[model samples]
Target: MKFGVLLDDHLFPEWRFYYLDYNELKRQLKVRTAANPQGKFAEQDEAAFVEILERELEKVASFRALKSDELERRVAHAQAAVDSILSSSDKPNETRMRAVEDELNKIATEMTELSKFVRLNYTGFMKILKKHDKHAGFQLKPTFMVRLAHRPFYKEGDRSVDSLVIRLSRLFDIVRTGGIRPPAVLPGGASQNFVRHTTKYWVHPDNITEVKLIILKYLPVLVFSSKGGKEFDPAITSIYLDNDAFELYLGRLEKTEGAEAIRIRWYGNMDQQEIFIERKTHREDWTGETSVKSRFAIKEKYVNGFLSGTYTMDKTIAKLRDRKQKSDKELDEMATLSREIQLSMLKRKLHPMDFLGYGFDHEEDIVRFPYAVLEVKLQNQAGSESPKWVTELINSHLVEEVPKFSKFIHGVATLIESRVTMLPFWLPQMDKDIRKEAPKRPPTALDLPSSSKRHLSVSPSVEVIIDRPSSVASTSRPNGPVSERTPLLARQEEDEEEDDDEQEQQKGKKSSDKRFPWRSLFASGSGTSLHIGAGGSAHPNAFLNSMIARENAGRTLQQQKRIVLPVRVEPKVFFANERTFLSWLHFCIVLGGLALGLLNFGDYVGQISGLIFTVVAMIFMIYALFLYQWRAHKIRNRDAAPYDDRFGPTVLV
Candidate 1:
């Protein structure tokens, strides 16, 4: 039989057979099987399995047909309630909101119950088919349909079933849609006996988007509302607990099997009120097919006291220790956790090591469907990594090898590196000095070359113009090819008779004879050299090196002239500069705009006060701007000088 077609055919078929009880149904099936001895299901095993499955299917079909009208009515009513909440023109009152939430929760609970019944019967029938037909690959785990008795959602407080109801409803909705809209909202409160086996992969930021796409295609969202259902990674904060000697940190670093990392974890920013203090303990089973991770949660608020060595787990431990009252399977585990926490506090001198933050995203296949149910079994490698749904993510070209990333260790190391020498090896090292200034412009042929001259002097004013040779100059004319001949220097006439005497004296001096001393322009005296290199290129390296040297020397001279001040003056002057700028802005706005409007401000005391404040604010703002740059320059150049703060403006009001 084609199982898919058969399931679809009988999905909503009318219930033709009805019996009072299970025994009656079994008797009827037995009699029918005995009469049709040579029929398809005459064999004892086949008959028994088919009979039991048929009974389950019949019960579901009959129940649905009897309650179909009532179910429809309830659904419509619930939808109307939801619509009322969503379509409100103004914010609904708390009472009305609660009523609507309750109605939705009721509908969700009913739907989950219905789905559970259908799934149970479906699995049973499939298992029987696989047993009878060799070709049928429908062997499935038959679900035992046992409805859990309703209880309080929390041990204390409001204790409403709204949270669980909402979760079940959302999950059913996902199954109905075949996971088209992934449920992103997380189930509120702690999950009792929750086991978390995590495998972390460090991927490049550039590849995060692509990796997310692959994850979305293959794995269902772990939470119901991650980033408001728009597929953005969540921010996680973990306050890690440790001791003075960092025993836990060392154990983790050494890869100790039962080393526990205790932390208070919360999703989103620090504003999250719902927090969980958990101790994550991992152990590898014998077969190693599964790495067992046991997590225990404590009160979130106890984290501070725990670090301070004032908190005790006496109350909780007492509850778990009551073996006669409640022998929970997790009681021992909880007790162990309690003992461990206390021992660490007493023996290790435990304290809060660091509060670290990181962005986290999980990769897993968590969705289930009726026809095609997939459970990915992960085989552990030699190391700490666990099985992930998208194996491509773990061994992909986009990411490096699995990194030894511990948030606690890294955070502690960052704050006090002298204590923790073993830093995380994944971080890349960077060079200490990186060029911050714009690159110096390359020298052109027009630049004057500097000659070697140790001693130099300059007149108050000096001008040197170097033009290309006559041949090169003519080539620059309208109708000529460009001349390539290089020109060294051009002659100049001086008004002072001292020039004649200086020239006569230089004739005898050997220092003035060798090539033009370009360095002389930047002599010890007050003088400026305007070198007009109007022509051809010289030896490429010579003039370029000279220009660079000249630039450096000039910079050095300016540095010598600057006055430095104490580091405290930097911020003071910076604020003063800001104030001056704001004062100028005030002057422009109030005087420029207000005075232009020609309001009769002179007649009012308020106007007079406004004018006074504006003037005062502007004066300070202007003084601030000037003082900031001036102080910064002096400080940078290493010149120690007192900073001027006398004229600093005070508030007019």
Candidate 2:
């Protein structure tokens, strides 16, 4: 009196009651009732065949209580009792409906044999949460209770063929603990869809403090859980889909409150992806559009791979500007804890930031100069606010990728501090637009050489210390490391220094009319000083199409040897203007103890008395560059500028 396979609340019944094997349905109904060929045995034909099998076990309880033409009239009366017991039935409805679909596919291959024939026991295990991301929009799917659990009453072969793969365990279907799992149920010819912010998790309770509270409050890479983590192992997650060669699109979030964020918006350029607090309130604007500089010069001139690793040093950024605070249920529990932290950091594969760091223009290593690619742009206010000036990317050689949503310094700063705003925002924004003073340093073969020694796969001693004007660098450390391939005397001394740069571009084109001249202000012929001019005179015809300052002297030495900014010296040119007037009297006593310690404290301090005038402007720019290098080395034995020559130093370190 106990045969089962019933289902209702969106069908689930232990996969066709532990894959239909009531002794193989009573040995195929006792070989179709001992071959009943009118060889009658009437006790009223065995009590009307046990009252039609007790009215099909009173319609096997509730699979949504039958109907749908009573389950196609009980699968057409179990295919006319398997076509009146076999007797060579042709297509009698496809051999009696493929013998009742071979008994519902041997009950879906014994319910795809779960970890073991189901023995489960769980109760109310709970978890549910939501946060303030920057604003809010989340969405989940469920519809009804997925599982309640109390089955209790075993029988049929008393269950245990090696416990059939433990009933597809999510530790027996996770009864939540904070948030993120409830979704599955599709089955009947399932379509296979999946994707949701690069998730990763394992090590049970150690969600590294819940994935460092979603990378310090929602920057999310991914997250997911359905148990399976007791100190981490079997758990693995990856959902990046969209297929057809490469569609890879993902969008599903909910969280945002305090100072609100998420402004992405890019369709054609700025190459997209920058939320790390808009790279700090637009620190001189334009953040990520996804670029690595032709993928780090094609992984260092054609797949040698390895762009940056030991960058040393971290915080010198004493806060230029950044603020977001989090709210939309903390960026949806940081996109559900960055998919268990990129599958617990085993993470691999993201490609295309010009295919990782840089790679689009390889006519071959041989750096002659003037051919580059990776450009990306998208800084949003919305509706393509054209104050104009994308001029088909003015004078393109490419590699632009500009986005600039802002905040860039604090976190999401990888690819080694974004090769300093991708080639200085692809060349030109100039001065305290905070890459701090620009014209940086390094590269000098006559302030950047190698015009062409048959593009000989590079390194003729870096075309001879950036090519030549003559200081002493002979090339090898433009901020450290290089000098390996040596020979053909750097291609026969770079073909006698490119036949001396085509006889000095034919004597500077007969002394002054050779036009292609702005070769990035000659990459550094030492013309220096780009104080955004005409406001102080640089006149190549006064702001001539604006990155201003021209008529070459290497236009401030290739715009201060272009790495595009951060290195522009000036603390009143190394101090002394009377120790910047006694360092503004100790910067007004740390700006009155950081505005009364942020009006009498709030959390972990009034954030340290609201940063005591950023440690009194970096201890008055390091004791006014150490009382002007201790009175300019007691009036001039010359020594003080060095830590990469500028930037990180209020005093030193």
- Candidate that scores best on TM-score: 1
Per residue, candidate 2 scores C-alpha lDDT tens digits across 49-160 of: 3344333333332221222234335434544555454444432344443445444333223332221122110000010101101011211112101211111111112123
TM-score of 1: 0.32
Q: How accurate locally, in lDDT, is each candidate?
A: 0.38, 0.25
Most lDDT-accurate candidate:
1
Error of 1 at 384 (Å): 19
Clashes per model (N, Cα, C within 3 A): 17, 107
- In model 2, which range of ten residues has the least summed lDDT? 121-130
What are the per-residue Cα lDDT tens digits for candidate 1 across 298-391? 5567756655657766666676566454456566666676666667666877666543222321111001000100122343334634323235
Candidate 2 segments whose C-alpha is farther than 4 A from its true place: 1-265, 269-277, 280-328, 331-505, 509-653
lDDT of 2 at 91: 26
